[model samples]
Target: MNPPNSLNPALVALDSLPLVVSLAAPIGVAYSGGADSCALLLAAAERWPGQVRALHVHHGLQPAADDFVRVCESVCTGLTLPLQVLQVDARHGPGDSPEDAARRARYTALAAAARQLRLQAVLLGQHADDQVETLLLALSRGAGLPGLSAMAPRFERDGVTFYRPLLQTPAAALRDWLVRQQIAFVDDPSNSDERYTRNRIRARLLPALDSAFPRFRQTFARSARHAAQAQELLVEVAQEDLDRVGNPPAIQALQGLSAARQANVLRHWLLRAHQATPSTAQLAQLLGQIAACTTRGHQLHLKVGSGHITRAGAVLRYTPLGDKAG
Candidate 1:
């Protein structure tokens, strides 16, 4: 983690946000040596000197991974911030993509580092442009409200808070700031690979949209904000209904709600019961079956990855499926 050459606008703007106070325990910044993440490290170190540490995960996919780690370590040394370099093998599973596998490995390394360092929060460099891309990807996949909401500024998982203070900043601004500071960063060649949807969105779709509509990023950001607000309200109402209905709702009680609300309630139930969210198609199929079933004892099984829903005896129960069964 290194401080900027001078107080940049991003730092000034971030400082205006409500400061999250943490004790002397170090704050982890997921430094990738990229412009965006390097900017985040700079801001975190500038704002909370001596309390910020940089953790860089080396995915070992690139030939220059060691060089990237060295750059991260050098930056941290310059700023007098502690650094942790983790090496991870991002091998894809049977049906998994390399990008997805790398992301999972990156987050796993970050979470483990946070626990080892006892950090309160891990700061990420996800900015407004990334948010727009995420929202667009979710929309392309016909995702529901929650998926359309994209990423949150702050969230807790595995006893550590993930913070995205730069969510309101654009990647261009961060890159410009880095250039102004004469900071050299690596540009991953994988970003140009069109095999990934995000790269296609970034290189082709977003640039074309920016040419046609200058404020496309802001528009998508605003849409995500509105969708997030609506999703929050829906979750509140669904939780209230869940409390009233007890553990498993009676078929009569479930059928009393409107189709949309029933889907919302079931979605919430599935999320809480399985500790993982269902894909858009899975949710739609589950809701479709729930609505189409007329007989009282009709059983509908909705499979969500490692979890499944079994509707038997007029009670919808979520159970771990296949090898996950306990």
Candidate 2:
């Protein structure tokens, strides 16, 4: 069999990502010294000399974390790029996913660093294969439109804009290009730890998808975009529906809407108004209960949010789980 690390002319000529021009004057790149981030940092620095700075988040989760930072510093120094490293506590809760905790902490630290640097946005190296893996993970978890939407190329977090310029390019091509250029980078060992769901998908499923469908990443990304668009439309309709239904949501007003529309409106209200996200099963059950409420005495109670959703006279009210019944 051919080697896994071999490269060809097609890979060499693979498409490059377009940068966001509106990200203010000194562009910040989330450089982890990995092949992907290294390639992105080099390209951005080359395109915008003396205007690109590398921001590295140091999550002290492993023994090699320091090594990663050292490599990143060396690369940035060689490129004559300013490098800033922010150390963070990435410890997860007892029931929390380690990867998720690290990701959230990394973004929080990056946003804080961006504020210190007065940068409005930072570039990330997430690529097409990463997008496909995200889509697959969402599907695996039986997620809704938002989860299937995967990652956006640009998004706002804590007043900082996060841009992923490489979402349209494949990961293999990025790594191959870095190798061909003889640029130095460090491989994070955790990436190959198949215990993580994303890692397993990346190591096993991606190759299978490549063989079964040569252009899977492109099509998968297209599907994610469609899902994102559809979700935005749903959110729009839900907003309109909520305006008509009114806050505290009159039961009579909600009953006038279709079951799907009722769920949409409730989801919008709970999340946007109260910061609560109900599961698909819970939402479906709540919709059924809403349809069954025929009399004033017909009490409805649903365990959702951080609280219980209950019908109080003509309107549905959400009370925190530990609060006394009113």
Candidate 3:
């Protein structure tokens, strides 16, 4: 389905939120009592009543987290919807991106909660501004097609489906809608801190986008969709390439393909077979090394992610750091 293409407050029609949430029934709304989520929750409850579940993940990263939970509880109680608050440890270690760590933790918590609660799908409140920030961040970091594509509207993980029905809606529309309805929502303090790249992008870059391109959120999102489509096609090609190379691909056979195809298939293999993803530079370097492998006696070893891409004779294998090469 094409994402809704406007951030104009009018786009948040009375029925729009309910319309989006109805598509994925028996869904758990990832509620945080923020404007975006509050609007979503209100609409879902009004539309489906007993069908909607409010799932709140308490990251415990901020002092205001407890307050957020209280707000979510109050809203859920008022709406007569069941609320489940899952507190999680979302600390980022040295050298780890806090955003990445928190995201991983959030998803983990969601999956675990979904399993425990036996929910079919989880809905998120991420909006068009988030999409723009993601795309811009991907550009800033020189990420590849996969990164540029950003978040998927719907994806399945750990036997549960995740839906982002508001991806096409802008944050402004959500806030305005809530204001008109006189619904109170808390602004996350951490979101204003520019120490994080996403926060900086949201605060500084978003306004600049508004001035330069009045509807840049939708435009940026369209570009992201294009990138996502392109990435899907590449993934298909990589899958086909993998089928030809056989499992634990033979080094000789892989070296026969072009550099780009080699990179594609290797990326597919690493992610699927080893649960590891590498940077573009790392993939290119690894491809160069594969090209340099001219003899059976030549050793094949390079660090890729938290593992080493090692050659066990003709077969390329991934061994986690410090694991036996077998």
Regions more than 4 Å wrong, model 2: 1-24, 322-326
How would you encode candidate 3's per-residue C-alpha lDDT over 1-326 as one tens digit per residue? 22353233423433454334444446688898888778777766665668888999999998899999898988888888999999899999999989989999999989888888777677788888888898999899888898899888878888888877777888977887676666678899988999989999988889988999998988888989999999999999999999988789888889889888999999999999889998877888888888888987888788999999877888888998878885
Question: Would you give me the overall lDDT of model 1?
Answer: 0.81
- In model 3, the worst 10-residue window by lDDT is 1-10
Which is superior by lDDT, 2 or 3? Answer: 2
Off by over 4 Å in 1: 1-6, 276-304, 323-326
**Clashing pairs for predicted structure model 3, backbone only:** none
List TM-scores for all candidates, in order. 0.89, 0.92, 0.91
RMSD of each: 3.3, 3.6, 4.1
Summed backbone clashes in each candidate are: 0, 0, 0
Candidate 3 lDDT for residue 7:
32
Error of 1 at 226 (Å): 1.0
TM-score, cand. 2 vs. native: 0.92
lDDT of 2 at 304: 95
lDDT of 2: 0.86
